[model samples]
Target chain A: MMELFFKPKSVAVIGASKNPKKDGNIIVNNIINSDFRGEIYPVNPAADEVLGKKAYASLDDIPGEVDLVVIIIPAQMCVQAMEDCARKGVKAVIIESMGFTETGAAGKKIQDRIEAIASKAGIRVMGPNCTGIVSRDIATTFFPIKDVPRGNVVMIGQSGLLAAGMASDIVVNQSLDIHKICSIGNKCDVNENDLLEYFGNDEQTKVIAMYLESIADGGNFVKIARKVTPKKPVILLNGGRSEAGAMAAMSHTGSIASNARIVDAAIRQTGCIRADDFTELKDFAKVFSTQPLPSGNGVAVVTAAGSVGVVVSDLCAEHGLALPRFGAQTIDALKGLFPDFMPPSNPVDLWFAIEKLGMTRALEAALGAPLRDPAVDAAIVLLAGFEYTMNAVEEKVVQRIAKECGKPVIICTLVGYNRLRNRIVEELGRDLPVFTSLISGVKALSKLCEYGIRRHRFGDR
Target chain B: MVEFRPTEIHGLPGFRRRFIRTFSGIPYIDVLSHADNPAMPDSGSENFKIADPPCIENEPMPLNEIVARARRENRTVLTEIESKQILAQAGIDCTETRLARTRAEAVSVSAAFGYPVVLKISSKDITHKSDAGGVKVNLKDAAEVEAAYDGITQSALQRFPRAQIEGISVQPMARPGIEIIMGMTRDRNFGPVLMFGLGGVLVEVLQDVAFGIVPLERSDAAEMIDEIRGKKLLDGYRGQDSVDRSRLENMLLKLSAFVDANPEIAEIDMNPVFARSDGATVVDARIILRELSEAESARPVQS
Candidate 1:
């Protein structure tokens, strides 16, 4: 059922147009540029051809069976087009056109009519007001996101612009890997529950991140999430957690936000990780999608500066991730790499080692000590302004630490230069999660440990 | 009909049961823990006999009938005695309260309850007794009880002239312990959600609470208790005695069961649930039943 929307063999662009910059034209162009394996048939009565493909007058004119339909026309005309798609036996439809439910009563009536027509024909609709979806097999959205990073995280967002923003960040920054992006705007037909059920079983999706203003069905979502979370981590960032924010969310998406504490408890009850902000969403997505879950809440911090170590240690404690006191053997091993006068600790400050032992060896020892320690469950390596010698922080060392210790390592860099930041990010991000700030890195590790503790509590893994 | 099968999860501690119930064509699987089946009618557990059981025989009427009577009388709020009665019938520990309509009755009830009894004006209309000067706690003797009764009744009448005065309720003053609040409010989406917090007079000022959906399991109750910001206060903060956590967990489970069983119960405020080292007891309970519409009675409660 979900494959019809994601990997359809044949899709019909209902409002396909020849005019450049139009939603109908852009959607067809996206499918063409995205290397979608499916056959695209343009259906526009006014145009003879759209983006070098012959345009049919209507869905009836298309000879092949349509697996999916993208309705990009006016809201008032959506009902008729849906009926036509139903007649054509299209199983999935993505309505990118706005002015439904979000516009109040008159629009809601039309949206309800569309739902009735589609449900009677047994067709699943993505949205009456949405940005549509993007998959690795095919990108069906009109939102112009270029060179999308295809990885394991499936993002299901309620807001179209928020989905676009997250996709653009993943694509442009190349930080997080998003396997599937579905903008479930208005949720006239398909809601979070349906998408969660589908992607929960999706093998390609390792992590599921959602940006929801208000959940359509809270009880069922929690039920499905409780089942899905044990297998795959589901991280959600709720938009309307405050009263004023809730009011704004209502005006924006026409959704009444559930109480924050109630929603928080429910989210926790389902064993889903809650992201405090969009940055934390990306942070958690990067770690959860990439790194393995830590066995316990014990975190080891390795930093170049003692001040950075202090702040991150405090954050670790705040987020329930403990910085364990180093044992004699672990302290002895760490002290062997550092000066005799300076005793070794959990943080393992490498300020002197960077100058004495060079960046590569210093990083290797500082990170490897905690990673190799049996007392530590996870490791956080902090690097500051090592732009030129980023390769010195060997990927092999990080990978070896992960493989041997059966733990995850996170790196947070405090580089001021953008070129160096991007270089370090592109270099080390492939092996370990490279965070821009200390708090995000610590919090992400804390979140990973939280999932670890919860999964262990449920005896899932 | 459904059959229960014993299932063993490898390397796990508890005994698990898989119950498959099919309604229409959809099959629902419920994983239940069968650890420690609570023995009925005195299994020799601490104070189990003293607790009021569920109104099993139904001669004195069930909660639904009491709610229906209140609805017929056009009363939205239940009196303290009626509220605690409903709670006690659900097997929850509530303060032993007696409603006295006259001065003599108040003095006699206070004497029977022993010294250091608390007096509060009992009226269906006056929800906040403290604000209306209707509460007089720690009344030691019969003379003090008489004066408290006069003051409470006079103040309640002065506050709301049109309100009907039910009389004063006398309860033995509970020992000082950690104050916690257990409550339920009907959420628009998720029916009744239970809330736990560090409570008492400062509950409003503190506003530290954690909520959970009803029909909570033992693990759910444990997590709810640990989720609160002031959770450490329950563990004997600043030289105070630690609360009985298992007893608190049992209270939460009872609240969940009560909330789940009574669909007409719209809101329940069990404030100042005095938590001592031995067990927790409900000091004040307020249960408000659904009075919006007759149509609500047919609506299936969401779990």
Candidate 2:
């Protein structure tokens, strides 16, 4: 059903522009720039041609059957343009124009008219005030984000700018691959449950993250989410958490629960994770998409600094993960790698091991020992990958061990500078996510463990 | 030497005397004589049966008709007696209630129920009887009962001069036990959701409640009970006897079923439901029916 919107055979840009500054031009340019194997028809009344393509005056003037229509005109003209698209038998329409219900009562009247017309014609509408969609196959976003990596995480939300910003960040940082990003602005006709059902069944989507100002129908959302989350996980971050925000949410959308606790309990009962903010949402999405969920709550802290281990131990307790007492065999295995004066413990601090042996050997033994232990469900390796400390660091070996252990291995770095951080990310973050701090690393692992434990109880393989 | 807590044998003497006084057919001579050797385990902890109330066969009322009448009269909140009757008809236990119009009727009802009894002004216009000073508890004698009857009626009449007076209701005082609340409120999106929490004044101060959508299974009830922060208060706190959790779970299940069967019920507040080891009793209940929507009223009739 979503293929009509995403993988259209032909798309007609209703309001194409010749100037590069215009949103119309950027949208057409993005579609032409990406690896979209589809026909593009630019329609502009004033221009005969746009961006090296023959421009038609209207969607009716398009020569062949247009599968999807992209409208970026003024809000006043959107209803007539929608009528023209519906007459042309376009199955999907994405109205990228602003000034819908967000403006005031007058704009809301116009939006309601558009909805009635679109529903009567049986044409699916994406948004009236949105950036449209950014998919791996076809990109129609007006934003200037380039080369979003094609992978298995779909982000669909009400905020277009937030999705655009995160898309650009994920693509630039190479944190996680993006299969599809949609800004479901206003949700005049197409809402979250429709898109959730679509992506929940999409084979390309492994995990879904949403930023909901308010759910259109919370009970219906839970019903659909309960069915989808068993096979794939859904992480939602509700925005209207404060009293003022709750009041604002009433104007934004109609279905946010008055009590935040009710919404929280609903999310929990549906077997989905509720993230606190945008950063946690992105963090959870990255870890859930990249790492295999830990089978238990026992985490092994393998760090270079003992203070890092202590802080992380406290965080583990706070997050409901535990640092188990190492068995004698595991202890002996770690003791063999470290010096006699520095005995091995659950944390398996690598200070003396690196001082006596080299950095590469000490890291390899310290990281490998805990990952191989049966008692440890997950491992967090803290590396101070500075210029001098990581002179002989082997990222391939670390990544290979992480993959071979069959459990999740997350790496945190103490290297503060962006230049060195980029290098560390380039090396280790390719296979495993390299968190910037121990707190983030612990938080992600704890979430991973939470999913694993809940999956066991929910009995969803 | 072992020192037993004073609360270990609370109400025991009175309970034995009541048992002997009430039931003459049962043999109590041997059981009373063997009080010294209380270690006898011929029967498996039958003394716990003291908490069980006598079962009564209740005739189900015309709830649908009652709801329709309330809607016709444009009433949203049901009186406490009406709410408890609906609940009792649905198989949940409630205190025995009788409307007393005159002071002599109140006295006789109290004497029949074996005082001390409770009296409350019963009127459709008054939702908060206690707040209006329309409630009196522990009316120990005929003079006290007459005074309470007049006092509650006068206070209620003063609070709302135009309100119709339905006199006062005489009820047997419920036994002391754990106070817990079980209620249902209709959400705008989700139809009806059940709420459970610590009852009485602490319900507001603690704010320790858990909610679950109605039509709950046994597992959901158990989970809702366990999720509340005051769970330990019900599970025998500080050497006090624990209320039966199975009974509480059953009450939750029954309430869920009741809400599921009655869609017209907009809100049901069964606050201060005295939960005991044997069963739970609804001391006060309030059911608010959904108002008829404007759309329905505006629709043209076929006739």
Q: What TM-score does chain B alone reach in each candidate, compared with the true chain B?
A: 0.75, 0.73
Cα lDDT tens digits, model 1, B1-303, are: 122233222211221111111111111122123223332212111111111211111123357666765665455577777778888888888888876655666677777778999998776666667888889999999999878877876676666544445456788998878888888776666666787888776766677777787767788889889988888888999998999888888988998888877877777788879998988888887777665666754554322
Q: After superposition, how far is residue B195 of candidate 1 from its true place, in Å?
A: 0.8
Candidate that scores best on lDDT: 1
TM-score of each prediction: 0.85, 0.84
- Candidate 2 residue-wise lDDT at A87: 92
Give the least accurate 10-residue stretch of model 1 chain A, judged by summed lDDT: A248-257
lDDT of 1 by residue, A1-461 (tens): 97788888898998988988888888888788775877899999998899999899999998888998999999999989988988888889999899989999999999999999988999999987887887657776776655666689888888766567767767777777878889999998899999999999989899999888887877788789988999989999988777532221101011212378778878878888899888788788889977888778878888777898899888888888888887777777777677778888878787787778777777667777677677788988776655534557544556666667678888888865777677667767876798888888888888898888778877879
Model 2 per-residue lDDT tens digits across residues B88-125: 87888899776555566677778888999999887766
Best by DockQ: 1
**Candidate 2 segments whose C-alpha is farther than 4 A from its true place:** A243-257, A338-342, A388-397, A414-418, A425-427, B1-60, B110-117, B121-165, B214-219, B240-250, B253-263, B293-303
